[model samples]
Target: MDQPWLKALHVAAVLLFAGGLLAQSLAVAAALRNDISPGVLARLRQWDQRVTVPALLTAWAFGIATALDNGWFGAGWLSAKLLLVVALTGLHGLQAGALRRLAFQAGRPPRGLGRAPAAVALALAAIAVLAVAKPF
Candidate 1:
């Protein structure tokens, strides 16, 4: 399709993916303190599997499409943005694993996971700057 629409979809998908990761991060952090019900964790897992995962995949697909369409493959800013996106994606996987462990097994989340939300925020901010400014 058109470049503008493609970019818009990519942005929308990224927003959804980022929102999901933030929500998951908070939930995992909460699990570290209070006892979140297994049912709630299950619901979160369902949401992650159905909505968040798809959104992440969509974001990747549309992002690559936009980059190809714009011939931005070699841009330094794009590379930096992609690195942040990969980090976010990996963070999502870790969060999902933590949620599963919390739901099925007993114990606190892995150390340092409580700080993931802030990290996600920072990465997202950096990504936004790179995307908007394209500053190398």
Candidate 2:
């Protein structure tokens, strides 16, 4: 309920989202060469459904809570950070789609998706800068 604890939980959610995305990205990349093994695909699906998705939702929920709690919704820097968060959310959607496709792959899973994790990393870095510096 307190601001500090709420912010800490938001950060933890962000970290969970990032880690899950990283693992999913790597797994998808591996699937590009060959069909992901059923076992691996199952695990990946479970992670996506149970962990990754929930973490992302939690991050968004807590982020909005923090922003409104602290009266930060109208700041220029927050707008930029929100844009980056949208980007991250879009990437998350695409990754989820790719993972779904991987589940149905007969062979030769999708390629050119290896860049997703890197993009997420970049987005996260930019968001961190905006949050810390609020330079706008």
Candidate 3:
């Protein structure tokens, strides 16, 4: 409700989203060895819908509102952080689409999907540093 609480919620959501992505990525990568298992994909679907999607939405909503409320748009640090966040969000989209394909279309995850977890981890690290250091 309040700004501080909202910011806390945003952080929590980001953490949950990141953790879910890592878990899903691991599941997907493992699934590639023997084709996507229906059970695993089913679990992934539930996790994404129940946790990842909501967390992503909540993070963005609270983050955008906080930035606007504080008028930090013009700051160099904020801009850098936003850019990284955008990249991470794009990764989220890719992961979600892959999950859907595996869940519905019985698609095999491409070999390239294996690299996603690493990307997310690195992006999250960079975003954390930018947020903490606020370096230009």
Superposing all C-alpha atoms, what RMSD in Å does each candidate have to the true structure?
Answer: 1.2, 2.0, 1.9
Model 3: residues with Cα > 4 Å off, grouped in runs: none
lDDT of each: 0.91, 0.84, 0.82
lDDT of 2 by residue, 1-136 (tens): 9999889999999999988887887777777766558689789889889998999999999999999999998999999999988877887787778878767763444566766667777888999999989997
Against the hidden true structure, what lDDT does model 2 obtain?
Answer: 0.84
Return the top candidate by lDDT: 1
Query: What digit string (tens of lDDT, one per residue) describes model 3 on residues 1-136?
Result: 6889878888999999888888887776776676557887888889889999899888999988888877878989888888888887777777777777877766777788788778778888988898779787
What TM-scores do the predictions have?
0.95, 0.88, 0.87
- In terms of TM-score, how similar is model 1 to the real structure? 0.95
lDDT minimum window of 10 residues, candidate 1: 102-111
* Candidate 3 TM-score, true structure as reference: 0.87
Question: Model 1, stretches more than 4 Å misplaced?
Answer: none
Q: Model 2, residue 106: what's the lDDT?
A: 39
Give the range where candidate 2 is weakest over 10 consecutive residues by summed lDDT.
Answer: 105-114
